[model samples]
Target: MLIGEVARRSGVSTRMLRHYDSLGLVRPTGRTVGGYREYSEEDIRRIFHVESLRSLGLSLRQISRALADPAFAPASLVGDLIRRTEERLKREQELLDRLRAVDASAPFDWRGVLRIVELLHGLGSPDAARRQQTVLTPAEDAPVPAEVLAEAVLAEADPYVAGALRWALARAGADGVASLAAGVRSEHAEIRRRAVRALAELPGDEATAALADALGDSDPAVHRHAALALGARGTTTAVPTLVRMIVEGTNDVEAAEVLGTLAADPERTDRLMSALAAELAAPTADSAVRIRLAQALAEMPATSAHGLLRQLAHDEDRAVAAIASALVRAAEQRPQG
Candidate 1:
């Protein structure tokens, strides 16, 4: 067959085939007198085998070495890959555990308010501290009031004050949505994040929309919280934004969970299936995301995602592969009336 026909049949691009040939990976069986490459059935089998190995994460040099030896066992290669993958996952989990430990140790500190206010007021400068002393003192002989300096500190510490004020504002009315929305525009990112979470708890269309916009916040944790809040709303309108975040947002587990909710929409099942398939093929995708996608694919009716699930059943990621295999088995066992 021609290059186009081979690509169409094998799902491997023509350019990739040429590159493979250049590397002696899958050389064509014959060439026409006019110099056109012609591949045989054996060549197609070899190409599929190459794809299968590549999907299993074998490097070109490793693949070449394996192909050279007739005694090479694909199962043994898969075992090695699985061992390496587990080691990497173990390291990643260790790092995550350490970060969680650090976060847990440092609870919110109100003392930061004094430090930030002092820096903002230029109190670190010798002359500026002297000027503050003069301004703070009523007279050379008169004692300065502690209450006055405390009030000045509160005013200078705008971010901490704003957070406290917003919390207080939440109690101002039965509807916390409006007050939280106002705080979303606060100069402090932490305040905005808190406000977004607060608004998320309130039930309304306007509040949901505002929280959706908050998913684009500069802080990753804020964006993740926003996605979770929107997911909690569980409305159809939030689906589009959640779907967008699942596709383009950071590799956040919260966002992936939200995407799983959005995938429940019948109208989105096909698109979600396609995205899941692409994710299964992506080298850089998070394992958690891939597993979630596999689970999502498994939950759909047998007819909806059978082919994709079948492809994933052989994935190098054992967890995903097992899920896919179970899905495929369940699909096969379903009775046909």
Candidate 2:
């Protein structure tokens, strides 16, 4: 059969068939005198097998490798895919946890809209934002002009009102981020904090940087919210600012919480361990900060972190010593290289 006929029979696009051929995943059995491709029953079966593996979320590379290796069992391939899917699911769960944490800190009155905004922010995709907006703004309400509701929602401090504001913002697209950014400069600190937090969810480099700036806001609550927003987005640029706050600032507790999540990235393990070591070296470092940093380091699996944690087990503070001991015990359970 020709490529078009094979595509129609297999339900895979002609372009994809050609791509599969290029990858040596599936190839036609023969070619006509004029160079037109001709596939046989065997080719069709190979195409179906490729389609089945693709549907299971195996990448072309994985499928290619599996096809090349006679020793690769189907069950083993499926188990590998399942393991990758589970890892992705775990990452999604972590993002959800960060979103929930941000939602809890948002002003209660605007919790509903903030919750949606939090979810959208966590998604980090335009398509997801649009889908979420559709669910929050029902079809029946589509005809209602946004201006009519914006005034009412923004004027009140109720959670419902805040929710409405967030819904309207999602519907408004990029304008929402701009308007919210302006709102962050409001005279009211609470309003500024809430607006900043909402804007942090919006997509843009400017919005991310603005959230980082908000970390230095005089209000500890606002600063904390900024830290959470930056952490949720996985903005590594804000890590230096957060590290300083946790290591040397007054709001050490809140800063440490945010840094713990940020440092969960294995790439940042060295930086986190180094920072913790520096804090521990300071004789004047607050005991609470030392304990928090030690706890954060313990959660990481880096070898350097394990050494630091073992040393922390001997701290004078009983609570810090106990946490250190627990970390050492946890690390010991892992098989040695």
Candidate 3:
């Protein structure tokens, strides 16, 4: 086959075939009387092989080495190709995401598009201060999309940056709730924890519902943050998690305060008091646990809590009795509401 016939059959252009020959990648096996390049069957097969390798993202140099160097191991080269392809895919996906975010923001002009692109880049910056500035600085002209903020809020690790991201998401409002909710279900424990904390800062029923759903998360930290948020929202579902937080002494003080808020509702007050009383009565409930429960009871104002406090005041455990007695005396001294 001649070069033209080879190009027509193998889908390799004549120009490329000549370039391949110049690089000594695939030289025609013979030439006709007119001195035109002629390709043998084996030469055409090598051309097809080079094309196939190029399709797999192999550079011309790599392909030449792969075809000619008997010592070149394919396994390592294939692994390298895989890694490079994956990196390229990651970059493309990030670009697609940025474009989608920009389009979703409905930028009015090139400047608007540039602003959002800048903000997105800033949010993903490795420098924590840069990420903070991305959230803190508000463009009166072009606002960053809420989805972008939500994504940052979920992935952020720096304490200060995370706080700023949460504030930005909250300011963005319900728009970021869906993203934050997805974060709540993330398999990563830290992500789930950060997600709920950010959700707690957001307003609206969506965020509240997400927090309520997070109350059942297996991570105690997740449950603590969700319960605190739900309790403040006056949701009864947070009662159990709030009580558990108190017993575990993890943010027990804030948990008790939120429980006190939840207890303001008459219907919920009994349930909250009963949960505390039951935990205190558990045989496995150690003295420290009992003392935390007694401290929590001081925050509850319901009549049921008063009765439980009275019972605890005379308990056999000296430390438990002392704390409970102090709570009761303090309650007695209060001018009855």
Q: Rank the candidates by lDDT, best first.
A: 3, 2, 1
Residue 255 of model 3 has an lDDT of 89
lDDT of 1 by residue, 1-337 (tens): 7778999999999999999999998999877788898888999999998888888788988888898899887787789899988999997875564344334334245454333333223322345444354343324232222222222222333444434333333333224465466556667786677677556555667678778777767776566677678766664444444444554545444555665666567786676566666766677666566666665565555677788888778878898788889878987998854
Clashing pairs in 3: none
Candidate 3 lDDT over 33-53, as tens digits, reads 998778988998898899999
Q: Estimate each model's TM-score.
A: 0.40, 0.49, 0.93
Best by TM-score: 3
Model 3 TM-score, 2 decimals: 0.93
Which of the two, 1 or 2, has more TM-score?
2
TM-score of 2: 0.49
Residue 20 deviation, candidate 3, in Å? Answer: 1.4
How far residue 20's Cα lies from its native spot in candidate 1, in Å, is 98
- Candidate 2: misplaced stretches above 4 Å? 1-156, 244-261, 264-267, 334-337
On residues 131-202, what C-alpha lDDT tens digit does candidate 2 reach at each position?
335435543312223332222233335554456556655565444454456555667786776676566556
lDDT agreement with native, every candidate: 0.62, 0.66, 0.88
In model 3, state the lDDT of residue 133.
89
